[model samples]
Structures are given as structure tokens and as C-alpha cells.
Target: MKKLTIAFLIITLFMPKQSNAQSNGAAGAIAVGAGLLAIGAGIAAMEDMKERAELTATQWVLANHPELNSFSLKTLDFNGKKTKDMSSTSVISFKIQEFSPTDNPTLDGKKQILLAFTSYGWISDQGIDFNKVNWYLIDSTEWLNMMVAYAKVASKEKNETVLKDVLNNGLVVNKGIKAKGKTEIPFFKLEGDMYLVTDYSSEMKLVYNEKTLGIFLKDTGNLVQMARAAVIDTHEFFFLTK
Candidate 1:
């Protein structure tokens, strides 16, 4: 984790777009996030390192998400054909709140557990492949972080006023913003210090920074940014900003 922290600090220090000004104006924030993704892609070039990083990341998710102290992950081939030496597309869907393929039916008709690694598209043909191969776990809600991601975006887009007026500062779970049945889940909360913690009921912590929308897995007091999940402009009712 020290290694990743050093990497993060280096990135934060060197990131050129640390300003709020952009030709695109307020829209620049999205551009800034995009820039960060490009920076992450440029940070490495090793299969072994990528594997270890992904595994560590998976462990973090297991520990923090859905109160799972023990879980297993397996490498999947993705069974796709268009593999043309690091394509820009990912076989695994990076869709916000992505669900399992409906066609992949199960005997009991329950939704299959899926914790897909979505960092490959960011890595490109020459970078640290955090998830070199596609992956999915069995019977997992670990991906609910994606839903938390939607709340993050909505907090900025549709509900920006709610955040600034009500939650500009508050304790974590102790001070949560209530949701309607449309977006209510008893487990979600805006943890103090701005980490949007989802699994508040567990010893492990699954948090997403409202500032960066970077989802992390926390265990034993260490935080690791395993993935960046964002919903740019599409809200249930709001339109995209120009």
C-alpha cells in the first residue's frame, strides 16, 4: 500500500490541471477527471505488477464491501474474439451500476454476482494492467459501489444544491442525506471527511470520495483507490450541462 500511496502522491503533485479554469468553464471538471484517467494509464507497464495490484484491490473490495470477510475471485477469459493487441474497448462493461448479462441464466433465477474490474480500458496497450484479464465473482453485491457512484454524480448534477446547502460539512453516517424510494438504500451514507461509505454496517469500509468519485476499499485503516466510477451527465431527470 505504501507503494500505491507514493504513486498517488506523485500523481497529485504532478497533475497539470489543478486549476478550476478551463476554456469549457464548469464543464472542465469532467475534463479534469478525464485527465486523471489518462495519467493513471501512463503510470505503468508490467503484467505481474498489474496482477498483484488487481488482487490487492479485489481483497480490499471483499473486506470493505457488503461485509464479506472472505471471498474468492477468478480470472476469466472474457470469451471475446476482437482482441487485437490492446483494444480501446473493454470486454467487461464499465457501465455505471452495471449488471450481469441477463442471458447468462442461473438455475435459481437469482442475479449472478459480478465484481468486474473496469481499469483495463484506462491502461491502454502499454500501461499497468490492473485487470489484465476480465473477472467476476459469484453471488456478489460488491458492485453496489457503482450505485454509490450514481449518487455521487447526482449529488453534483441534479442535487448539487442539496450537497452545498445541506452537506457541505457533516459527520459520516451520523449525518446522512436521506433518499427517496427511488434512490434509498439503508446502507448508503456520506461518511465524514467526504468518503461516501456504503457498507457502514461492517468492520471493513467501502468508501468513495465525493470530491473525486474515486471508489476505494479500506481495511486496517489503509485506503486504496481501486477504481474511478462516474456518471457524467445522465440523470433520471436532469439534462447534461453545456
Candidate 2:
């Protein structure tokens, strides 16, 4: 993660020293440096939030499903994703499930199963962005950037229609919609005055026949104990870090 961050800093350093918007070299440097500084600071803050969210997720796993102490985990970066992308999730599966649960319906009706999790945030004319797509594939990042672009147009030209257009765009983009046959998933909401501003973390569960699989322990005795007892003893599941 730090390596990727270093590359961002390097990009800022290599930006052109002169810009037509600046009257002189000193002015240009000052303006550019200030923007870069804000971006870098915001990135650092958001990174910290992401780490905190990950730790909270780990705790949830331990408390609710201790067997998953060995569950494979992965933290992925989704900041650069565009609205057209289809990768809404990442999954982790095991090689075997010899300790299948009775009445389990996965892996030949055995308890062997697959698991997945998700987290997302967005860029608000700043450096940090989180990505998730579940609708017509629009994401917070794309919508925010579009609003800013339209705002710039209205600001520069002072057109009432431009402002109205931007407002309409926001309405269409963010207005909530419902999907059929969707089951409620468990999630953690991370929102505050600091880095995460807006985001959520979740582990996807599969529901069918009044039971959920894929890492969901539906109030059956001590969940952590059940997890610990049935989980795979291999490298396929682990707590991965940046």
C-alpha cells in the first residue's frame, strides 16, 4: 500500500512546473503544491480509515465466526473502477469440506461452500475513491465527478440551465431504486467526520430454503465455535493485509 502511495507522490512531483493559469513560476508552484498537499493529506486519512474498517471486520469475524480465524481474507482497491465495470465482488473458496454440516446444500449438498465480502467509498473532488456497482452500474465516483464537471460549467458561464441540468443529473444518478429477488446482506456502516466520510463493509451470504451459507452462521449455538470446528486447516483462508 505504501508503495502505491509513493507512486502517487512521485506523480505530483513530476507535474509541469508551469501552467497557463498561473501568472508566474512562484504562483504556479504555490497553487499546484497546495492542491497536491490537500490530495496527499486526504489520501493518507482515507487509507487510515480503510485500515480501521478492515480491523473492525476482522473483529466481527472473530466474535461471530472464530473458525474463520483461519478464513482467507483479501483487501482490494476499487478506486479506479468506472461505471461500466461489472466486478461488484471478490470471492474466496476452499479446496475441500470434509466436515460438511448435515442438511447443508452446497458442494454436492454438503457443507463445503464459497465466501465473499465487499467495501466501498467515493471521491468527492478529492484523491480518495471507493467503488461498488449494483444498479445500472453507476458508482458514486462517476456521479460525483459528473456533478463537479457540470458545476464548473455553470460557474464559468453563469448559465441557469447548466445549474439546473447538473441538479437533474444528480437526481437521476442517485435516486434509489429497488431490485427484485434481492436478499438483505449483513454489513457495517463506516461514516464519520474523518476519512471514510461514506462507505460500507459487507460479507455476502447466500440464502435459500430458509438457510444462508457462505460464512453466515444463523444463530446456531456458539457461532465462533462452530466456525473453528468446521473451517479448513489450510492456507486457502487467511487474514491478508496490505
Candidate 3:
């Protein structure tokens, strides 16, 4: 986490020495310093949030599914997909380094499992949106195909509508569709237990198979505990079953 220091700001302000130079140089320095501070603060906040989320995920695994602890955890960057706007997600990818006795046959055979979480201030005052936290079993072939598809569109410098059209109808996985035995979304083939976002208050919870699993609050005090438990439980319910 990067922080802006008062000493740095003061030094920047004093770096301008002459009469005319003092006014313009000091103003420019102040602007640059302020920009740097804002960038630093933003980066620090993002890092803090990711750490908190990861901690919460760890707690969930430890408390409920000690068996899953065998799988190594890797935290990825904040942006799941690059966009021109403020939209982004924090990602955590779990990989099974080796075969384990407790591993789910379905999950253990795969390369990696991904968990993507995000919070949008415009959507709700609540911290992380449970529904927005997505889990997926990574299929390297499908992923690569999607990436190549996207790259083709990107290379063409297509307009936004064209790009969206490609995403909506370009890449089709007949095998995924047949295996899923359902209609597929443009870029995604939905699988596993589905969940809906029902609460946005100070506390967050998810109800699945008639079981409620959370009293998670929307703050950093118990962030690790909240996130870890929620993630592990959710994965067990959704991803593990798949």
C-alpha cells in the first residue's frame, strides 16, 4: 500500500525558488504532488480490499472445509477484464498442486478454479456483492479460444457495437452447450448452483438448498473472516458440486 507523506508534499511546494518561478513552479508541483497522492491512495485502498477478501476466503476454507486447504491459493490482480471505465474485479485462483485424498474427483482433475469478487459503490452501500463474486472452473481450451476471439475483434478496431455483437454471437461452444444441456450466454456457459443477491444491508447472507450461510458485515474489521467463510461455503455449494 502506497501512502502520500506530508513531508513529500512540503518538499515539493518548496522546490520552487525564484520570484516568478515560485508561483508557476509551486502550482505545478502541487498539482503533480496531489495527483501522485491520489494515485497512491487509490492503489493502497485497492490492495487493502484484495487482502481483506483473500483473508476472508482463507477463513472460510479453514473453518468449514479443512479438506480444501490442500489446494494452493494464488491471488491475482484486481482487474479481471480491462475496460475503459471504472469497472474491475478482484480475482483469486485456486489450484490443486497434486492429487489429494480429499479432493473432489470433478475438481481435482482440472487446472485451476477462479473466484472473482467485486464491489460497485453505485450499486449498493454494502461492501462486497455476493452475487458478483463468481466462481468458474477454468477450461484452458475454451479460455484460449475466447481470448483469440476477443483479440481478433480488438485487432480489427471494431466499433463498440461490433465488439458487443461478437461477444454476444461470435464464439459458440457447441460442446459446452450440449454438455450443459441448456442455452448458453454469449461468453459464458453457466454451470453449478445459482445464487441471487438478496441482502444489501450491513450484513450479507446467501440462502441455498434452504440453508442460510452468513451474518457477514460490510466492513474491514472482520473482513478476512467474512470473506474466507463465504467463499469456501459458496464454492462447496456451487463449484464443488459442479
Candidate 4:
């Protein structure tokens, strides 16, 4: 019973917005809990949580969001193990389908189902903290366009300018940010010495003064070979400011 209480406390404290995995939130607690529990049960706990999360998320979505019934379900990389490395936060994303036939397509007609958890452990969406759990939509077409622009720059077929347009436009189209036809690269401003980690498999990590802020961007390998370069260029940028 005490262990269960501890787990609940862990879950409450770790609930993060968009699974940012701050120095004080989700990543730290889950990493410690997983490490201690693994000594006795091996590394299955995290994987089990992921599986349960998928089941619960699927059910919850179908029940609450009938509009997505026809779309396919796909579980995205949640960065559960990478949380231990502090390279990324744990976020579960499900891509709904090939295209959006709805009267209002999210982005060129595509939908994304996203759910965030405080830990890798499976907790029913009902039992989980509502503040952390989120079901949102992303413009898949715009995101793909950004990736294609990056590929162009990588292959030397186009300059960074094209990529920049796609990324900034994505923000306006998907997020509805009031940019007023301007380029706004999402970046974090931190104080003190900064540490930049570039892990191709993991999301981009922004560490400041030895504490991890969170994963700034996903699939950063496509942005640029080095994370710093991605932030420095016009077509692509992470925008880490001091």
C-alpha cells in the first residue's frame, strides 16, 4: 500500500505540460523510480506502462472523440527510456490517419492524437491528473513540409530560407499564434552556462547550468547535424537565447 501511495505521489508531482521533462518534474522522478524497481523486476515496468497507456488512450479517444473513428491509430515514440538520459521528456503521440476528410482538416487534412503522462506507468486517463493529459491536433502536412525543406538543405538542393518558411508557417497554421506574417522560431531563453546535446534518436535537449529544460524540438537530426547549427540558421533554428 505504501508503494502504491508513493506511486501516486510520484504521478502527481511529475505531471508536466506537454511533457517538457523539466529538471524538477516528470523525468527526474520516473528515472529514479524505474531504476530502483528495475533491480527487482527488470526493465519491464516502463514498457508495460506504454502498452497500457496506448490501450487507455485508444478507448478514451474513441469514446470522447467520434470524429476520429475512421482514422487509423498509430503510437508515436514517447521517449520513455530517454527520460532516464534526460535528453527528452516522455510524451505519447498517435497519428490518426492518412488524411482528414472532415469539413475542417487540421492541416492539409491530417490529425494527430497526443497524450502526456507523468510517468511511464500506465494509469487510466480517468485516474490520471487531467492537467497533464492532453488531446490536441497537429498539422501533419505542414510538419512534413518542414521536414522536406530540411532534406532539401541537407542535400544542397535548396537554402535554409525555404525551411524557415515552412516552420514559421506551421506555427501560424496549427497553433494560430499571432505572428502577423512574421517568422517566429520557438526558442528558450535561459541564464548561465548552457549545455547542448544532439541525439539523433532522441528529441533535442536544452540544458542550462546543468539542469535540463526539456526537449525543444522533435527529430532534431533532420534540423541540422549539430543542434547549435539548427538554431543558428535562417531556414531552421532552435533559438536558444541567454
Evaluated with lDDT, which candidate comes out highest?
4
Candidate 1: tens digits of C-alpha lDDT, residues 1-242: 64467557665654456464554454655555765676566454343544654465565455556644333333222212122223233322211122334575332322223334343344555644544433434321333334433344434333444443322222112113333312232223454356555543333344555323332323223333332221221111011111
Give lDDT per model, in order: 0.37, 0.32, 0.40, 0.41
Candidates in descending lDDT order: 4, 3, 1, 2
Off by over 4 Å in 3: 1-20, 59-66, 82-111, 117-126, 137-242
Clashes of 3: 7
TM-score of candidate 3 on Cα atoms, chains taken together = 0.38
**What digit string (tens of lDDT, one per residue) describes model 2 on residues 1-242?**
76558657665664556544445665656766776777778678876755654454445445655554233332332222222323333222222222334564333311222222332332234532323212111123433333333233222433545443443332211111111323112122223221111111132122111111122222221111112112221111211111
Clashes of 1: 3
Between candidates 3 and 4, the one scoring higher on lDDT is 4
Better of 2 and 3 by TM-score: 3
Structure candidate 1, residue pairs in collision: 113-140, 172-191, 172-192
lDDT of 4 by residue, 115-219 (tens): 343332334544444343434444444444434433332233344565445444433211111144653432333343554443322334322222222233453
Kindly indicate the candidate among 1 and 2 with the higher TM-score: 2
How much is the lDDT of residue 209 in candidate 2? 12
Error of 3 at 30 (Å): 2.3
Location of the lowest summed lDDT over 10 successive residues in candidate 1: 233-242
Alpha carbon deviation, residue 207, candidate 2 (Å): 16
